[model samples]
Target: MYTIFHAVFGYFFMLLAVRVLVRRPGGQLTPFEFVIIFLIGGIAILSTIGHDPSVTNCTCAVIAVGMVHRFVAMARTRWRRLGRWMDGLPLVLLRDGQWQLDAMEGMRIEPDDVMAAAREQGLTSFSDVKYAVVERTGSISIIKR
Candidate 1:
């Protein structure tokens, strides 16, 4: 009874926090990002499971959360606006050696981050960068001139 209710409510809160806070994909997790991820999981566990520590309660919560994620994914495909809102549009941070400072600040990105991405793509300098985009997945993509 209360177990089922806790599962649904706890899962919903965890899911909402994830959507709002986590910006990068798994592969791109920096040390700071990794810490944040672990902290979020720890807190979510304390929150979602409460003090039960029962396998049945945990499994129910997992299943409920998984189903909600699946539904959101399916709906995202069917509704473009919802998709855009859930996952923001990509932002261009640099173009032709010029910086889009406002966009970088809005995304909490710095020039050095873009330069590091450009370096990954074998670009030596900003002059060689045709464009730098912060993709919706939170990875920087650099286009070379």
Candidate 2:
């Protein structure tokens, strides 16, 4: 019973921590961010399971965490606002050949990042790009003119 509560609390705590700390997508995570993620996961597991080495406790903890995750997923689907808040909305970083400075600053994105995405799309210059968006997944998307 206490294992279930601990697992639930740990799950939400990790979710909130990751949402606040990680801005880039998994594919783009730097080594530093990867270390942070691993450390957080380790801490969450230790805190959730405590000193219990019993198979029963481990099984219960796993099930509790899974159920909590499933519930959150379902709730997000049913609530648009919750989904938006948890996952975030797509942000425009560039528009009509101009940088959206405010949006870029808020997202901690620089022009170089946008240009790198553009270069990935075979664009050599911003003048050839019409728009750049930071997708909900933290991927930069470039629309070329």
Candidate 3:
């Protein structure tokens, strides 16, 4: 029972934490980011299993977490509003060679990141960018003029 409870709570806690802490949409995870994620997984396991090292307890906890994940994914697909609430809507960082400073600031996106996306898209400068949006997945999408 304790393992099940922890599994459910940990799932939601990590969900919220990720939404708050991670801003880069689809950006490659830095080594530090990767370590943090790995540590979180380890902590979640410890919390969910507690002192119980039994296979049954661990198995039940894993199942509970997996089920909740599947339910959330299904709910997001079925309900657009829920999906938007969970994942957030994409924000326009640049449009028509003009920077949307407020939006960029809100998302903590740096100019270099936007410029990198533009360069990847074969744009020499923001002047050649029709649109640059921070996608929900945390990666920049650049549309060239």
Score every model by TM-score: 0.87, 0.93, 0.92
* Reference-based lDDT, residue 50, model 1: 81
Model 3: pairs clashing at backbone N, Cα or C within 3 Å:
24-138, 25-137, 25-138, 25-139, 26-137, 26-138, 26-139
The residue-by-residue lDDT of candidate 2 on 85-107, one tens digit each, is 88888899999977888899998
- True-structure RMSD, every candidate: 2.0, 1.3, 1.5
Worst 10 residues of 3 by lDDT: 23-32
Compared with the true structure, all predictions reach lDDT values of 0.80, 0.88, 0.87
TM-score (C-alpha) between model 3 and the true structure: 0.92
Candidate 2 is scored at a TM of: 0.93
Error of 1 at 71 (Å): 0.6
* Candidate 3 overall lDDT versus native: 0.87
lDDT of 3 by residue, 1-145 (tens): 9999999999999888778878642475767678777788798888989999899998999899999999999999999999998999999999876889999889988989899888888788778888999988888999878
Decide which is better by TM-score, 2 or 3. 2
Scored against the true structure, residue 122 in model 3 reaches a CA lDDT of 79
- In candidate 3, stretches whose alpha carbon ends up further than 4 angstroms from where it belongs are none
